[model samples]
Target chain A: MECLSDVGFSGATVGVVAKRAGVSRGAAQHHFRTREDLLTAALLHMSENRLAELRRRAADLPDGAARTGAVVEMLIDAYTGPEFSAALQLWAAAANDPRLRSQVIPLEEHVGREAHRAAVDLLGADETAPGVREAVQATLDLARGLGLASLLTDDEPRRRRVVGQWTRMLEETLR
Target chain B: MECLSDVGFSGATVGVVAKRAGVSRGAAQHHFRTREDLLTAALLHMSENRLAELRRRAADLPDGAARTGAVVEMLIDAYTGPEFSAALQLWAAAANDPRLRSQVIPLEEHVGREAHRAAVDLLGADETAPGVREAVQATLDLARGLGLASLLTDDEPRRRRVVGQWTRMLEETLR
Candidate 1:
């Protein structure tokens, strides 16, 4: 994951990743036959880690109005940092690579669904209600867009204000 | 632009782009000193085209309630298709390449602010009102996130639903 985030997909070759992990190239090859295998495993590992982190944070979320704000914050945090960076690299590469696209699409769909389910739970949102599901999706999408903005620069000040606004909007929608 | 969208950053070398453009490599190099120059120019060209298209669409938008929905649809349209796909490739490459990052950041900032301003204008939104600016920003962000989603799958059905929900939210917020 670090390899992908730091050097990007083009640079994260098996030899480089193996060296980064302090493992021999042959040993890395023994575990994963191709670069695709290695990359998919890395992304999967990162996704699981992200879900685990979200669950961990949810356990400690405050109740009531504060919970909505906390949930928005958690979702934004989920889309930033090294893990998201790695995923972005893969996503960009996968956009043009057929084999990588096939691997990434399903993984992304699973992660996206899981994240949506988690958000629904964290926000105490009832999806059956009109506009409820789309509202939750909008919130997730906004978080992702904010993450993309942060990749180029320190978008925190603007991002914070946006998050504050979104939290209020989400609270109203869920209510 | 097509090269970037079709083949990605690594594949859209000057030689390849020139070939696609039916120009000699030397002629391409004469116009753009490096691949970075060519890409920046392409992105700039695309941005200008997008902004012009937005203005053209804005001129025809209906008055009152329907205008908000039209504006939201326009915003979502701005973030999808080949132009956005090419930009995505550059953005991903720029994330790790400082030279490209320096160029892309300012360009993106310019494009983002212009899009935001355009949205504010089209919706007749009052940014001075509390949360109004952030609401506009969120709308743009959601459009961008939806664009990312569509890169891998046909997300139009869900995207349309989200846009519908957002149009309502935006209408209320602007009110």
Candidate 2:
């Protein structure tokens, strides 16, 4: 997944993936036969790993402030990091390759919906509430944009401010 | 830019780009000596073209209804299309390569800020208003998320619905 995100889909060959993992090609091929299989497995692994991380982080909420902080942090770590990077590669690749598209689109959408639901829960907000869903989506979307920005330029402080301010904005909007 | 977005940094070699553009390798290299230079030039060209299109689209937005509709359309087109895809490529590519990061980060941020300002104007919103900046930012951010989803799947109807709903929400907030 990291390799795919780093070099993109066309470059994430089986041999490259194996070499990046510090394993022989034969060892890698033993588990996954083709680049597609390897990449698909990696994408799934990334999504599941992120979901677990979100749950663990949301395990103990200290207060409203801490909860908000946790939510923002999870949003950044989940969508703006390697998970998103890999997804970007897959999304672009899937556009051209129908086989991969059929496999990737649903999985990618599922991850997005799952993240949305988790965010709603973390905020202790009802998705059905008036304007609540849009507000929540807005927060995540803003975080994504900030996260994308960070990828271009590791401006941690600016992204921090944007996400923090966005969290507060959502609080008021939801209220 | 399309090549980078489609195949990513590593796959968007000079040869691939030249082929994609239907130009000779000599012709392509005459303009950009290296892959990084080619991609950077392409990225800038994409941004400039989008800005021009935005300006042209924003030319005669009608009253409240048409204006909101136009804003939503512009938001969707600007972010969800190839422009964002290429930007996504540069973004992911810039993550580890500091040289690429340095080249891309500023360009990405500048494009972002320009887009934000244009969005504000397109929406007829006041950037100086209280919470207005964040509100505008959120609107663009939500559109971006919707756009990203569209790239993975042909969720045009759903994305259209989200953008329309968010536009209404922003109308209430901005007013």
Per-residue lDDT of B1-175 in model 1, one digit per residue for the tens?
8999898888999999999999999999999999999999999998888888898878888999999999999999889877878898999888889999999999989989898888898899999999999999998888888888888888898999999998998888899
TM-score of 1: 0.98
The lDDT of each candidate is 0.90, 0.73
* Inter-residue clash pairs, candidate 2: none
Report residue B169 deviation for candidate 1 (angstroms). 0.9
CAPRI-style grade of the A/B interface in model 2:
acceptable
Instruction: List residue ranges in candidate 2 displaced over 4 A.
Output: A5-7, A19-24, A62-70, B5-8, B15-23, B64-69, B96-99
How big is the positional error of residue B117 in model 2, measured in Å on the Cα after superposition? 2.6
TM-score of each: 0.98, 0.83
* lDDT of candidate 1 over A146-167, digit per residue (tens): 8888888888999999999988
iRMSD for each candidate structure, in the order shown: 0.8, 3.0
